[model samples]
Target: MFWDHRLTQICKENENLSKYSTYEIGGLARFVAKPRRTEDIVLLLDQAQSSGMQTVMFGMGSNLLLPDHPDPETIYISMRDHIEVMPRGDLLYVSAGTPLSMLSLFGDLSGFTDFHFTFLLPGTLGGGVYMNAKYFDNVMCDYLDTVYYIDLDAPGRGIQSIHVDDCQFAYKQSIFQHQPWFITGADLKLKTTGAAFDFERINDYLNQPLVKESIDNSSLASFYRFYRSYLSSLEQGNKPVPEAMMNVVLDRTGKNHFDYPSCGSVFKNDYTIGTPVGKLVESVGLKGTARGNAMISPVHGNVIQNRGGAKAVDVIELIKIVQEALHKSFNFVPEPELVIVK
Candidate 1:
């Protein structure tokens, strides 16, 4: 209980886990800490190490499944509020907690286009870098110059960094996954470092009531509305939205991404098979399948949705069903892209 008083300022007890995950399907969690600083993370990790307490960290809860019955003794740490952005000469120093979508917005307003691919993408930058989050040919590792992180297995060492090339980034994979490291921040290469950039504009946008509310809301529909309206406002103000960004909106909306509560994709595509997982699921006639309150999305075969009050168990059951059916039909079981936290 040595750290209890300090943690009281940032931690919540018996919080609803559904509000933290995109799937909106978890039961109550005993302890959830929203750490806004790197020092806070270190302290929490240190305490856990000394006391033999279990701990887990997540960002934005965009691609995760929290347990229906969480371990009461475990402490869940959320890195969503640790946002920080600083422009250093030609490079931008972005904290891991910064939203990946914020980079897209910053690029648009600061006269850069390379980050347009990330527009409306969910999750924080740390999670993006960890999984090498991608949009078409563009990936988080593409523009990264250097990444900084803490080794959770050895928190006594403090922060360390690695160059982008040394990160071993691949399709939906990164060295972060192979090591027990906590991403703190990174420096990104800029297309044009000489231009005068007003980064405070991004801060202003983030501070708006609607933007703040949307950032906290786990509802996919609300998330879509905020970004869509924000982009329209930019257009009305004589700032033309990029065609690439518009195309992203069209693609995601056309696929009904915001129509339901679900993780965007359930399985990673095995490119060697020469068939997408969604099409495979559809071929197996499991696209609209349901188990309890969870249903395989009728619109997107790779997505499992929460109809209303789905439980983590329901989603797990459906995953099993998909794996068995796919293995029987295709001779290979597909791997899941979504992270199911125990």
Candidate 2:
């Protein structure tokens, strides 16, 4: 009952989980909390622990498959509003809830092209760090200096920091995936030469009506439109738009990433298998396969899309089909990249 006094202000009952996820497929959740600060998160943890409730935390829901029926006894925490960005000497401290795409915008404005790879990348910084989210040859941990986290099993220990070198980052894998530590934020080492990093300008961009509206809705189409239009505006103004950044636009759009409701990729590529997961799906002739309204994207074999009103069960069926087919053909089931909330 720790949250009893502030229940109305801090949490919701019988909320639709769909509105919080890019997939937009979850059923109603019994309890949901949107925490805007580290203190709020700690407090929520206290409430959950005291009440003997399980806790589920996520940001943006870009790479998640929330259950159709979440446990009524669980406390679901959405970290989307817990955003903060601060400059510390040669490093930038970015909070976990900050969108990964925003870093690409910062790079565009500040003349640092390092973050260009993240352009149009879905998900929040925390999730990116959790999975070591990658694009082409670039990976998230490459730009990080230190990561700050709170041990879920030991909340009284408060915040802890870890050097990037010790994070055990690999292709789409990070130490955070194996630990119960909750990422709070990270310090990104800045490029020495760039048009001076303007914190206010970056905040101004995030405050834009379109940007706020797009991010809050959890609609991939809206997210894509805002970033694409912003980039196009820069192009029209004759500002230098990196070729790499433009290629990202073409690649994602060409694949029709935002055209439907779905998590980006269902399975991680198994490099040891000598074939990308998409190709394997294609080879098995599973492209465009559907279970209910969820279908394997005809264009991108690795992507499963919600054609319309797809349920979590529909997507899960497609996932199982792919896993079973691939295992039969290749003798190894591909590991799923999509985090299915049980």
Clashes of each: 0, 0
Specify the poorest-scoring 10-residue window by lDDT in model 2. Answer: 1-10
C-alpha root-mean-square deviation, candidate 1: 1.6
The reply for model 1, stretches above 4 Å from the true place, is 2-4, 191-197
RMSD (Cα, Å) of model 2: 1.6
lDDT measured at residue 116 in model 1 versus the true structure, 0 to 100: 85
Candidate 1, which ten residues in sequence have the lowest lDDT sum? 190-199
Model number with the top lDDT = 2
Clashes in model 1: which pairs? none
The digit string of per-residue lDDT tens for model 1 on 138-224 reads 888888999999998887788899999999999999999999999988998865556544677866866778766666666777778
Q: What's the C-alpha lDDT at position 186 in model 1?
A: 92
